[model samples]
Target: MESLLELKDVSIDFQSKRKSFNIIKNINLKIDRKMKYGIVGESGSGKSLTSLAVMNLLSDNLSIGQGEIILRTDEEKVLNHLSKKEMRNVRGEDIAMIFQEPMTALDPLYTIEYQIIEVLRYHRKMSKKEMREKAIAMLTSVGISRPEKIMNDYPHQLSGGMRQRVMIAMALVTEPKLLIADEPTTALDVTIQAQILDLMNDLTDEHGTSILMITHDLGVILETCDRVAVMYAGQVVEESTVKNVFDNPQHPYTQGLLKSIKTLGDRSEKLYSIPGNVPTPDEYQELGCRFATRCPFAFEKCFNEEPPAFQVGSDQTSKCWLHDEEANPNE
Candidate 1:
């Protein structure tokens, strides 16, 4: 299948007075039309930053150091170098984002009707009546009850789930070709989270909109994504089909993540967790593998040199020395 979006060797850096540091490094991702691609990792693992890079929404202090974020539709375009005006034109129309926290993403001062209509006003030349009808319909489609009443209500007037639905409606209001859902269910309760995920899945399926789902939750990735990328300390440690990742995790980070998930009838006294915290960008190793510090299977080679992505299967790869054929000849 042809790719809808591709991030090739994308890296983002944070600039400081004395020096600069990498935040996200060597990100390579491909999202095909109607494909649900999940990026899973711990907090501060650059999952959200990767999505922001795709959207060209990174902060002023943080900039793409080297790489191409290519958006392929009727024609291919590099998003990193686009002018502000050009980016604005593409943002809501071609690529829309549903932020992690709807409360902060949505303007509390504006009515839901106004907010939804605002998107149409910028992207389409619809009349007030037409925009209102479309907005209400969108709310209804997202499973919001009494759409008309919800439209008049402010962000605080609705519950967390309702607020999230409003954010989804605003994002999809333009019927964007690619949707970047940054932890869309993070703040919602379990029941509401499931409903929201189902609604997003159905809507994306209906619209044929590709989604880049950024979340730390393995369960959410398994439920919502067709392909999964496991990220640790900014870079992707493993990439494969969702089923393959769950069945045959390649990298140590990936293994740790899977092992941490609690399964039914497990007799363990405590939940499992990966030891050590994710290293900050500035703390990343300059020479050795960034994950080597916390990796259980790390050896002299892992600590002395970085490992390139080793092909594990036809469509699976891991950035770990364990998969290096030359280094592990006996295996």
Candidate 2:
């Protein structure tokens, strides 16, 4: 299938005094139309930054120093390497993003009706009456009860979950082909989180929209994503189908993540854990494999040079020298 979004040799950097600081490095990804893809990593692993890069929402100080992000539509293609003005038309119209915190994303002074209608008016040429009806329908679709009443209320009037629903409603109101949801359910209560996930899953399926789900929760990724990309220190260490990743993780870092998940059948006296910490981008400017510090199976070469993604299966790739023909002469 043709991809809805493709990132080729993507790299993001923050510029300082005569020096460039890298946040993400040589990242390549392809998100197919209507596919649910998850990007999982610890905090500050450039997961959010990557999503922002795709959306062209990076701040002025930071920029995509290298790489091309190609967004494909049946009619046209927009590249992230384009000017900011061109990106503005692509975001929300072709691609929409729902941030982690809806309260901050929504204007405090604006009513839900005002916000939703603004999106409808900006993106679609519709009568006022039609916009109102569409706004109400969107609210209802997200499981917001009494959409009529909620539409009249300001951001402070609704609970966190309701506000998030409103935000999702606003994003979907545009009927964007690609939805970038950054930890959409992280703040909600467990039950509310389930509802929000269900709503997103249902809505995406119904709209045939592709989703780039940015999350740290491995469980949530398994629950909502069709394919998974495990990132470590700003680079992808493993990429595979969700089942393949969970069942046969080739990278030790990927295995660490799975072993950490609580299971009833787990027999170990102590839970599995990936030791050490993720180095700050500045800390590893000269280092090779970023995860070598934490991986128990690391060797001398892992600390000396970076490993590129080596194909392990038809659709799986891992960035470890263990599988390299040069490193593993026996293979």
**Superposed Cα deviation of residue 289, candidate 1 (Å):** 1.1
Q: Name the candidate that leads on TM-score.
A: 1
Positional deviation of residue 103's Cα in model 1 after best superposition, in angstroms: 0.8
List of clashing residue pairs for candidate 2: none
lDDT of 1 by residue, 1-331 (tens): 6699999999899997888888888989889999999999999899998988888888988999999999988788899989999999999999999999999999988999999999999999999999999999999999998999999999998999999999999999999999999999999999999999999999999999999999999999989999999998899999999999999999999999999988999988998888899988889987878899888888778888888888999999999988776675346
Per-candidate local distance difference test: 0.92, 0.89
Model 2: residues with Cα > 4 Å off, grouped in runs: 265-269, 328-331
Error of 2 at 331 (Å): 7.2
Candidate 1 global lDDT: 0.92
Where does the lowest 10-residue lDDT sum fall in candidate 2?
A: 74-83
